[model samples]
Target chain A: MKILAIISEFNPFHNGHKYLLERAKELSDCDAVLCIMSGGFTQRGDMCIMDKYTRAKHAVSGGADCVIQLPAPFAVAPAEIFAKGAIKILLSIPEVSALAFGCESGDEYEFFKAAELFIDESDNFKTIINKKLSEGESYIKSYAEAFEACGGNRDIVTNPNNILGFEYCKAILRAGADIDILPVKRVGAGFGDGELKDNYSSASAIRNNLTDIRISDNIPPYVYNDLKYSADLRGFHSFLRYSLFRAEPKDMQRIIGCGEGLENKLKSLENNNIEKIIENATTKRYSSSRIKRILCANALGLYADDTQNFLGADLYIKPLAVKKTRANEILAALSKSVYPVITDANGKGLSAEGEQCFDKDRYEFAVYNHINGTDKKDYMVLV
Target chain B: MKILAIISEFNPFHNGHKYLLERAKELSDCDAVLCIMSGGFTQRGDMCIMDKYTRAKHAVSGGADCVIQLPAPFAVAPAEIFAKGAIKILLSIPEVSALAFGCESGDEYEFFKAAELFIDESDNFKTIINKKLSEGESYIKSYAEAFEACGGNRDIVTNPNNILGFEYCKAILRAGADIDILPVKRVGAGFGDGELKDNYSSASAIRNNLTDIRISDNIPPYVYNDLKYSADLRGFHSFLRYSLFRAEPKDMQRIIGCGEGLENKLKSLENNNIEKIIENATTKRYSSSRIKRILCANALGLYADDTQNFLGADLYIKPLAVKKTRANEILAALSKSVYPVITDANGKGLSAEGEQCFDKDRYEFAVYNHINGTDKKDYMVLV
Candidate 1:
């Protein structure tokens, strides 16, 4: 009863994600694959092109045995926090023997070394990072510089997938998790690539050309059907504008990631063209991704204290979809989990901490449902 | 130098509004007509069908010599507060000698009697009203019943315009302002009428049938052109849904109108259709209009303390438009106002109290502009 866990967004469950799932299962020699997918929003702070349940169903159809939702506070967050939440959930399951991830650099040894350097946070490395940060460099840039200075590969630390992969390793070590690491090399298009290349197109490429007929060749048939009524960040510009306009500076200060007068900066932005507003708010210290995460947090009213409470509390496993044939096995394995397993959307029998996280997740989904004008219930998908 | 003041919403300056203006001017025998109109929202807690600047331009084109904006906190409020804010603005100006309003009864003596009773708040009347409220009647209904019991005409107290006219009288007495009251008889259609009749149609009727060519016969040609790009509450459904979904019970409690656990009721509602949500939230204790006002206040994040502060502070005179022929005369008259006159949208040289209200007004307009995707400047519209 060995389960290999993968952390992913699965924004649309495309060919590239299917390939990685299959590769990871083969490499880890696991009985089943469990995916911890971002629920309503992605790490880049954009709402998923498709809702989480539909994406979970597509994941099961593609190859995964089960798909569990990563709550929005973690889903639409920085790499470290995202990895921390997913790793915490995977560690709670006693049967999860290995954690797999897709990355540009397949060298697990380099990842472990980088993860160690970050975990220890030596005084010298901290001093260098702080100096770079003081000079107004972005956090990622400062981290990469400090990693290179400390005799680590800057390329491995700077690449998006590799950064997330190492953050997962750091979280696993920090949590004292007894699991194996499996790194699968990403194929075809790069992480940031926005064009279809063969059958393994990036999710962004598919999303940008969602209406293009060629997209049918990239995603599963079910995913294509689900995407017919998908939503995007642009569709929520009015909501974002209203949220930002209504929030005072003090209110903005309470939102996660809005610090150091960022509230004033965001409030000063012109309320026209979401892209232009984001572009104007981006600075050397605050990357576009960071600003976007802040904007999404503000729109959803995700407070900093609430997110911190969620991070400090134990996570509950809430599966979005399970393969029909493997549902019994997955449920049996999850029964031995140290954390609570939420089988119902009403979230009965949850601890206070778990209830807080579950409530936020429900609220985020409610907003998504409202925007799409759908009453799609949060029932578990069987495929 | 005599100036006749009218407090209006004029969601769209229709034939009825034009008739009222002419009749009020004739009754007051004043040299100029001054209209203090709601800015972005109306008393019923809905966004105006057109932007305030465009509506002000239409008002000037119809008959008003000057149109001053009523800030959002007071604009989307109950009759008593709405009248209080408008009267305060009118009282600040030295030249405004008479306040005129359209009413069904058109009896100045009756309005004065009702105003005196409300201002006095006799213990017997209070006990009756409280008992009715305790029995689950709405505030308006309870007030009407109590007025009828106290030897007042129930019809006069219940009629929308007459109620507002009496409230205006009450506000004038409370402020001890030296202004005369003039009641103008309404014609053609009733205040709540939803159909076009002859040339004088209610603003709601014109709004409900905006695309109908018959509306052109009810409103002026310029207003018809503005209706081509008008916005309604339906257009703001997404923003409202998003705001409510994201707000916590505590956050809803702070909104001006969401009191007595109404926040919990609102938060518990299904976030589907805006109209359906409001309908479901309505009860004997909360009328449809009250719930709509609460929703609008929640959407705009209008807090109770902030609104109370605005009410207590002296209101500023911010004219949205002025007839080109009467610009000099109106500006000269406004110069003698005890409250500050804000000619610039940037609101320079304003007191702290004035600045807070002005900031809220700008934020509300920014949300409106964001929804319409227009950048119409707030310059004075000279007709």
Candidate 2:
């Protein structure tokens, strides 16, 4: 069987995500799709507008065969580390044959070449990058300049998919994983663009569309009703800024990519605009993306340094919805399967071991519950 | 010395409200403006966005001289009863010569006449209203029909300001107060338009605008700055709905005016949209406005159906702003003022009496905090 692993935030799984799942299945021709989704906080420091289990269940409903959690630390860490953590876990499963991801530029050869250049960190390239960084430009800018200085094309770094896709390949290469990298061209919408079009929609646009009842029609049928129901229930990112501001200066420092002095700047900016807050706290040495991840981590309570211990790379398939016969078949196969299966949450109360197995999932669910004003129990059960 | 009594919610007092206060002062030629603001909930069931004292302090900082809290039961009751609660308190003070208010139509006479007719109940108005309600029209439509049937102008009741102003006048007459009604024309913006425009903005618009950094220009300087700081603090209302939904159904039924199985409807909507949840629970006989009050009360920790006690109009004059020297002037006047002066709260913490006072204020603060994301301490303090 050609098994494939897909990684995502799936903050609140919607139709676009469903489409990605279908496309990944078609492209990889995998027997089953396994998703490693972020818990609690997302990359941008925004709380996963919905809880992760809700998102994970939605993933199952959207067609994922199983769902496990990306531990909090890497989930909100810098792209390189986030990629490292996710890749390491997937590679642990010797049976996993491929890794499929959505990227801006869908050219696998181009992305892999770029990844090779970044991973090799050739001496001349490193020298040029250091020289550019001394001039106080952001890392992305420095990287582009350095890439050009080294007689390499730098345009790939500018494309959103190329950047992430390159990082995924580098992580796989660094880990010595035989798992193939499958870069699928993102369909439909571009990131940071406000307009919604076709089958492709940016997660940002989808989140914005949720403020009104009318936009509920654009989401998939399975999630449409629930999304509308959740949207109507509460404000989105309503407490994000507040959570960041209220953090103890020490706690703020512990956030991913938020260095020592960054806390002082952030503390001083407690009374400033969100733009000023981000700018004042960020350093030239760090990329804007890094700063954003830090802010997002702070706001979402995903302090990276505090999340060191990682769950092992065992598959935990949470069946959101299954045919009764299929469920029975899957349950029977669990004893013979390569990894331990998590069909139910150890029945209601979580055992310490069970909680350890599912800490990331539980935290993500709690955050979602907090955001939507629902009890944590709402996201726990499968049936 | 002209002293004007303005009954208000001042829920998270913002720039538009500052305009109203300045306009009221100019119209009444009053040196001292006595604001009787709602505490926990409003006529609508939604929370006050901030605690009453915080809002009162903001109002005082903007313009008002003395701020007294309207009890929660009356504050969240129906328009007629809320007006009665406010009028009774205002009437308790003989020095409160002019009662100033904002009216949408800019016509006080029409509203006053309509109020007089309604209060007289001259021609079997109840039967006529019931008949119209049985036909499935909205309660507002039934109200308009009833007014037309009773030899009264329906046009007056259709105007939002006119309706509220009419209720204020009716309460004053019903209480047999000697205070004169002074209705001022509303300016700049309208309420519930679901869009932000001009200097005159609805509280909702002001809140929505706060979510986007670009809209900061529309807010007054102090208000905008305070809100920006507050948003980074914590999710103030994060657990509000959860607490309400988890409360016993019987306890929900105990809320004032929560009649005709509304509690059951609310129980079923534990995880639904906030607006839809409220709307479904609202009956033609019991307006959404009234139901909203009860829901808000439940969130604020007020027991059901405690509307019978007047709570003795505790604490006549709270100093919102002292101006250092103006403090002595207000203190001198309060010493001779007829109503009992309340300088300190009798309880230590959020005791029954303190909860009664603070819950309403906290409820309003919660709404404001939800919008602006400010820390509880960031709100302006009442002396």
Candidate 3:
């Protein structure tokens, strides 16, 4: 009954995602593989290409036994918060003995070593980060530079997955969690690649060029069918653009990632285009992805105070999809779980704050359904 | 020179609107016609067919000496609030001597008589209204029934314009303003008429059957050119539907018109289509238009408390369009006004509550801009 917990967005469940699941089982020797997936919004603040149900079905069809949502707050949060939240849920599951994830580095010890220094969170480390940030480096770059200055492996932080894996390990160490870290080397499709590759195409690449003909080789048959429909982003851009301009500097300060004079810059922008808004809001201290997340949060009326309570740990376990044979097992497991387990998207039994987070996610998911002209009944994808 | 103030939405500046301006000038015998036009959202809670600038330009070209926005809060509010806010602004200007409007009944005494009864707002009158409402009559129906029960002519409330005209006179009486009422008979297509008529089609009719040829006869040459590009309603419908279901019963209660179990009805609805949601939300006690207005306000985050402060009087006077000769005169008149005269959509010098009202209106206006793919520069409907 060895269960491995794999954290993913699985936005469209590309070949690389399938490979990661297979590798998680092979390396961790887990009898059952479960994924904690992002529902509507991804870490980059853009919506997933498809809804959570469809993406979760792809996970089960691909290899996973069960899939639960990573609740929208952390799903669309910054990497540090995203890692902390996911790791918290994984460790809480009781049966999830190991946290399996894909990284550029196959050696798990490499991440743990870096995690040791990063988790220290001493004034010395803060000073180093501030110094790099003051030098006009982006947040990720500043973090990498600070890590190198503190005598850690500088090259590991360059890879996006490795950086996230490091954060996950650090979160686990800080919490003194019992779960072990398992890092699988990414086989193909380097992170951030937006072009098609041999067999393991990057999720972004597949999403960027997703068509009926081009996606078959990249995703499974079920996943390929799932890609037949997608929510129109251009229409959503109007809503986002309206909200961005609607928000005052004070309103921006109340949202995450928009503090520290970012509000001043945003209010000064003259354009209403999303790309242009994000471009103007972006600075050396802030990444475009981070600006997007803040803007997206504002658009959804998700304030900073709403996410404060959920930062330290997972609040609820929301089941999105599971294999037919494993459905009962998953339900039984969730019933005995520590937090409230939400089987329906309505998010019953969640805290007031938790319900707010879930509602934002569900609203975004509803938009996805409206966009694709598809509904929940069509989300089941059999292996 | 006597300034005749005309309150209007001028959604497309149709022949009916032109006739109203002519009738106002002919009856009032004033030198300059000044229109306090609704900006962005109309009283019906729908986005204007074209931007305010274009409509205002048409007003100026047709007969109005100057055109100014009615602001967002008043523009989208109910008839009582709409009438009060527009009259408040009209009275603020020292030179504006008359408030003229189009109505089904050309008799001014008929409107004043109805206004005197309705402005009482006495316990006896409310008891009569509640009695009618207890029978599950619609708000308008209850008002009409109450009017007849109170020894007022029930026929005054039958026509939509007559009812609004009654409210305007009532608001004027309540304020104790010296401005005289000028009532012009509605010459052509009736309110809510949805077909092309002989040179005087309803705005709804023009909007419904808006082909290039069909609209030309209904509106002027410039107004017809404005219709070349139009955004479909489906994009806005997606956002509204998402918000309707996204909100809980309690959340909906915080918005105006969603109280008194309307929130519960909205929450119980399982549909995502705008029409379907409105259909379920509507009962004998609630009309379809009222439901649509509530849903639209909720989607735009306009809450019940937000409107409380603006209910008392006008917050700001904003110029939307002005004829070349009358620009200076309008500016001079506004300079001596009580509240700040806001010339731009940015809403400078407004009170804190005024700012909130302005922001909601501007945000909705931006959505209209994004939907139409037009900018403020094109809003100038020049004479």
Candidate 4:
């Protein structure tokens, strides 16, 4: 039986994510669906739209067999590190046969071609990219222009999910993984769209207008009800502000993804609120999402060295949620996992780095628990 | 010039404190009077009623020629260390001729005899004290009984301020300092009295009844104005709770004064609020003040080893406030002092332990500033 794996934030399991899961199962002819979902923090370097366990429960109720946490510094990391972290988990499990992801273009050949060009770029390709970047083109824009300058497809790297899909392919190629790739076409508005579109509302749309907008048509009922528990960047503002204020430049530069005088800029900022700090830190050189991710990473104590340790490999498997009916089969498959699997925060068998990583997760959860009036012990979701 | 030195919390700078200053001038005929005040954290290991700078300003304006901070872990230590920290500062300067303190019984002879007994405790007296402690007598009770058993004065340790006066004498005697002792009878209801007594009020009375009672008669006009800016422990609850949750047992045990199985009990506590934690931690062996002190020490990162380094002497002299008229005179005296006099939080010339101790003060002020919506850079008080 082939097992299909998906990497996602699932911020709230909407109809688009639902469609992707069903399509993944059909294309891979897989017996089980395994999702490595970003917990508490998201790849955008912002907090989860809702807490991890609620989103995991939605994934299970919507049709996932199991959900594992893609723990930070990967959860709040850049696209490449996020892809590497998720792919590393899949690489460690031999029984996991394929890595499926949703893309707006849904053309695996286009993503493969883009990944190859971007990864195997020569000195000529690098020079064009550097020249474009030096001209103050945005990071993604420069990448797109550089690929186009190299006689690659201009239209391939335009969509957000397709960009992520390309990153996933690059991560797989870099790791020399044997897992097959399955692409499921996204069936809704774009990933960055902040408006509800017919029956396929974007996660951002569902999150921003949570109180007034009825998004039941776009998301499963479990997810709709879990909307009441959704969180934003507000709750972490004061704590992050204090953490940033107490942190010196040297202390901040070690935070994963903080560089290029960003730490100096961050130290000089007058704002303690996350939104205002992000606003102040964002420049042409750094985007808002990138700054948000750096702030979340610093707040969670994720240093560059910690991220480097798990570049193309995972140290542990931390299960966030398990389908109650398929628990036995999932356990049987995971029994042969190459790394230690942790079901709870205090998993005793983790390596020193694994322990440190998990401890950071627990500490972040403790902060979340304190601010949101939740408890850390009840983080596991069963459906 | 016979300069008079006083030690005080002056948590709100009540009229009783004024009485001590006038009485000290009469006794010592001092050219100038100086006060060593606790910073953001007080001797009981709690935040001050107001910011340290504000309190220092009140002290300087009220009558003190200059006000210096007794930086933590000294400011928040128990009686012996508190006395030693204060006396060490006075001992370093030759111009400071005497140590004046408020006492209840007003008997200098009894205080002198008790100080001699405590400072040079005989082997037999030590054995008796240990036996009493082993028999489960309280610390103060054991000390009182041991002194009585050793045929020493029974009346000296009966009053709280008298006991503190004896500790001061003991510290001076142990250090072999030439400083004379001056005792001023407390003109209030009593140190622990919770009721308003004419023009004098206990700090507890003013703090606890700030809402309903008329306290203008009890405190100086400047202190009354500063009352508008007073803060309690409530603001620090969530941050401290998170700090305690993040702290391991070993980490907590390092916090100064966290021993005798206190760290174990602290780790086992379910409450995060300072008041609730203090309530739960209080037992027959420990008082509420001790628990509050422990919690403040832990929150400020004051460790057991930090306390051990300054067991008998302060590492630096930190001046918090100065009267404009006497500023030059005080600066002249401090120039030839045995220890470094630090006027700012970022004092460069300090011993390792001194730096650690002052850093704790600044950090505490940072928390205070964060919670109370103030700034740390504006901490110096000038009258």
Candidate 5:
């Protein structure tokens, strides 16, 4: 019995995630599927409109064998760390044969090439890259230049999903895991776009559409219930709210990427204008795009110094569904597997440790929700 | 008439401000008082906890001839901008004689000495300060060292009020204003220590001590109505509940001061780990004390880029005691003033043109209140 492992935020479990799930099953040709879900926060630096458990239930209802948690930190982090953290949990499932993800590149050939260059850090490329950076070019621009110098194509680097996909590929390579990647072209609208068109619209667009009644076509059924349920979870936006109230100018100067003299410039603010302070503090010396990320991280209580290598038991098998007729077959396979399988997150298996782990993750996700401007009731989850 | 200009947040007219008011009166012997109050933000880089109108009312109730807004940008700024912004406003008030402030070295003589040295920015002292700052020492430390090196035998830099007092003097000298200095000793608990002793308690300590109690000895009688009247204006901790729910690792980077690549670290988190994120993110490079401020600022929607310049007005005073005899005194003052003053911010004063300006100021102040962890209602108010 081949088991497919998928990690997701689901947030509201829109068409994008739904499409990915269906495609994963088709490609892996697995009898059963496993999913590790994010509790509240998503990778894009905003709160999930829905709670993880509700989204998990949807995953099971929509078509999955089992559902577990990917935790909030891994869920909201950048593509590389997110992939590494999630993969760590998936690799533990002894029966899991493949790890599937939606890749923008449609194929792994170029993705792997880019990943190798980034990780290997070729000396010839580094010299040129450093020169561009010393000229006060943005890091993103510098990296883009490096990719060009290496004769790599630009189309792959410019796409958001492609970038993340490359990082995901690198993560798998670094892990030296046996699990294979099932790369597929993403079939959805891009993130942060204002409108929702096809069934698979971007999460940002879907959320924006959700605010008005007109965008219902973009979301799945029961999304309202899920949104209402997760309304109290207190996402990252609320964390920004908290951070704004508690921080001081002198204190703000200490965050990484804040830069020297930037604090003094920020300190020069007169209004309660957070955006202005950031604009004034950010200059050619520091790209606004990079600074924005650091600022968002600080607002959401995410920063660089907190790196950790703690990987709990390698395999985390969470059954989303168990056919009553085939229970015996699944049970036999579970018993013979070398990795531990978590049948019940609240009871047996990893429930004891998982419960404690999940609580902390949920709390942070709640703050993320608030900072993203979701209503208070919108963040709380029924689960 | 000789008028004394005072800059303040007056965030609820606490006793600390009252002490400063009385001291300014006695020291300057000014005929009138002109207070430049921050509308939305404060020096701590957070929003004010109350609306500017209510705060202005409290200021007027506590005692002031006129109250003008410091404007949003200057209100939420650091000490230098905050000081400079307020100074410009006070000096613009033609009747102003001097600026009175409270300092740790309640002794005027010592404060003046520090102020004189600080304003001179002598070559020798500047060199010493530059040398110390280059070594990564804190500005406070650098200032103290430089002051001593300048042949000034004062070690009052660590004192919060004295430090501000010196900056205020510096701002005056820099502006070449005719205003003199009136320094009074602080007679309250220190800032952010959470200590409470009789009537002498820091605002932070008072708030902490009042945690669950409806009323406390520390709160003034006049401001009691405000606490009683306002409905559930969520506090910073409560907002954190909302923020964590929405924010992702990337969102944390958007807040001012989240640094050290901590955003990526927090992205690895799961639910309910807000406290852990704070603990993990803080280190030798980032202190918990500073992080708290950043967290608060983020929650309030106050960003470094949003800083504004008030030009001169900090607030447009609206008298709360219209029925009392003080109304005549206030009305008389408003009629003769060059800048327009509002009696009712919401009802009579908010014309289309006035509304535009008021909205801008109120919007900025609202953001500030978010940072200060105070409940704000009715963008424009009658106070």
Candidate 6:
């Protein structure tokens, strides 16, 4: 079963994502496309516009054959951890022959080369990066500066998709995975663009104009229907504020990515607006995205040691949705994979470690349901 | 100065509360009426209908000469702890010659007798109470049964005000405070009554009929105006849900009043509704009020040890509001009291223990403001 696995957030399963899935399948010539998608939260530290199951159903409806969850610990994380976690999950399936990703740069070789440059860190590179970090630059900014200093293309480190794609390459190389890298160039408004474009709009643009009729053309029909009751950071402001207020600095320090007095910084914020708090907490050393991820981690109770154990533990394949016509074949193939496929919502046959990882996903969904005041159950979406 | 200190929630400072204050002053013939009020939360384990500062202003408007806060650790606690903390605060003030409380019985001697019975526990009484508790009765129910079996009036244990009055007497006796007990008869509606009477009603009734025009007659005009923007438990459902979702069983166990595996009971609930969660968690052993207090403690992150320290520590006279005409006199009196009067919001001039208590109050107010989406600063309301 030649499966082409794609790592995505598919926050709303927009036209751009549809194009990537279709192109990746065509380019890889695989029998089926499997999507390892972020559940409840996106990598950029925002709740998915729609619930994971609905979004997975939309993914199957759009183009994918199966969609498995990228549990919250990794889903609501930085690019490095997010890519590593997703790549590790994909690599656990022995039948996964190729890993496809959407990137601004279509050249896979450049991503691999940049990955190698980051992997084989020289003394000079380390010193320069450390110096830049000490000067209070963001991790990404410091890395970009260091990469440029080491005669690497800074664009690959700066562009969001390119950065993710580079991290994917790094993870694959570090793990010595035999899967092929398939980079399908993103064709639309850029990843961070908030303005709608003709036919192919970025997910951000679609989310910004979710209530606008114009977004109807940018997302699938099912997605368009589900987007009406989408969730966002603003909807979660009260919970976030309460979480911050209740958490002492020591409690917050246990959260993943909350370190170097970030907990104290967050606790000291007095703004009621979520955006304002984020803006106030963001600094040269701590990016706004970093702050958002910390806030999301705090909300989900993603502890540092727990997340570390989750990353170190064996991967679990929990499919959120699969195409009805291909469900048996996908399940049968997944059953034979190295990782345990968790089909039951209660984690019937999962190992202890696997159950712990799956519980985080369940907890994240529970929080999402709570914030939206919905009782949506966790079930595999069958199209 | 013969100051009469009343322990009250004054959730909205309804007509019933106003009547109690007036009658307590007239009955006691005290120089001034000092109110030791619950801040942000009530003993029933619910968020106060209004912020402490606003409620204090309403208390002053309704005839309180001075109002001091009963910190949240005690404010949202069980009757025993609540009464003890409030009594300790009043005892610290040398001018507070008497502690007044509204009760159904209004007989101070009867309350003292009941208090004596509870304090002087016998082996038979203990065995009966333990047997009733083991048979799955609530603490109050068990205590009432044991009291009845020991030739004590069960009515004093069953009635809400009588229960509180009894606890106040017990606290006074335990502390050996020189303050006299002044029990004022409750008027109009009962404590748990949901219907409004002619002009006096329970705080619960006013809260239930907040938007109804009839409630305007039940509360002061300023209170009526402030009631329009009142905060309630329903408004805090998101925060509570998030708190429950983020908290592990161990974390919940550390919360004050969360014990006997109640944390597990709360954590196992899959419901999104706060009311439903409380109802489901409530059993024969745990009353609904107990469950509510646990939920409130969890939301405020009030740990068991911290609250224990707070109860054992020296009291801090943090005035929420004071009648302008008597402000100077009250301030002068309080400054000379045994406890340090914290006039600053920042907890300056406070002992480490006092600051810790004040921080909890500040945190509770912060959570209240976050839930209400308001940035109301904590200030001593004067009118």
Pick the TM-score winner: 4
Q: Model 4 over residues B61-160: C-alpha lDDT tens digits?
A: 7888888877677777888788888888888888889888988775666777888887678998999889999999877888889898877776677777
Off by over 4 Å in 2: A9-30, A38-42, A45-64, A67-78, A104-120, A134-138, A145-156, A186-234, A241-249, A258-300, A311-340, A346-360, A366-383, B1-239, B242-383
Per residue, candidate 5 scores C-alpha lDDT tens digits across B1-383 of 67777777765577877888877887677777767776644556433455666777777777776676765545554566667766765665556678887666645566667777876789999899899999998787887899887766455566666677777776777778777778767776776657676766776665554453433556667776676543233443445434444455565665555645765654443243446656775787766645555555454444444333234333344332332444455456544545555544463443443344455565554554544434445432222
RMSD of each: 5.8, 12.2, 5.7, 4.1, 18.5, 5.6
- State the weakest 10-residue window (summed lDDT) of model 2 chain B: B230-239
Candidate 3 local lDDT, A1-383, one digit each (tens): 56789889987898888888887888886778889998777888887788788788889989998888886777778888888888877777777778888887636777887888776766877898898889888777888778777777765677888888888888899889877888888888888888888688888888888763766888888888766567667755755655665577788898878788887777565245678778877876788989888877766666667667776433777777888887777667766667787766666787776677677667666655554445654232333
Per-residue accuracy of model 4 over A1-383 as CA lDDT, tens digit each: 46889998987789999988988887887799999998787887767767778888889888899888887777778888888888887778888888899877646666777888978897888898899899999777888898888767656687777878888889888888777888887777888799887788788887766775568888888788777776635546655765666577886788766866889888666334457678988887788988877777777787878778756344777777889988888967865688887777676787777777777677667666655655547446668
Which is the better candidate, 1 or 5, if ranked by DockQ? 1
lDDT per residue (tens digit) for residues B46-134 in model 6: 88878888888888999989899888888888888888888888888888888788888747777777888889999999999999999
- What shift in Å separates residue A2 of candidate 5 from its native position after superposition? 16
Model 1 residue B97 CA deviation (Å) reads 3.1
DockQ score, prediction 5: 0.07
- Provide chain B TM-scores across all predictions: 0.93, 0.79, 0.89, 0.92, 0.73, 0.93
What's the DockQ for every one of the candidates?
0.28, 0.07, 0.14, 0.15, 0.07, 0.27
What lDDT tens digits, residue by residue, belong to model 1 across residues B1-383?
A: 99999999898899888988988887777899999999887888888888899899999999999999988888878888888888888888989999988888847777877888888879999999999999999888899899878877776778887889989999998988878899888888988799877688888888788778888889888888877778746557766776677677887787766879888888777456688879988997788898888888777767778878887886688999999987998989998998878876788777788888998888788778766657778777788
TM-score list, all predictions: 0.79, 0.51, 0.79, 0.86, 0.48, 0.80
State in Å the error of residue A42, model 5: 16
**lDDT agreement with native, every candidate:** 0.83, 0.63, 0.76, 0.78, 0.60, 0.83
The docking category that best describes candidate 3 is incorrect
lDDT for residue A317 in candidate 2, whole number 0-100: 39
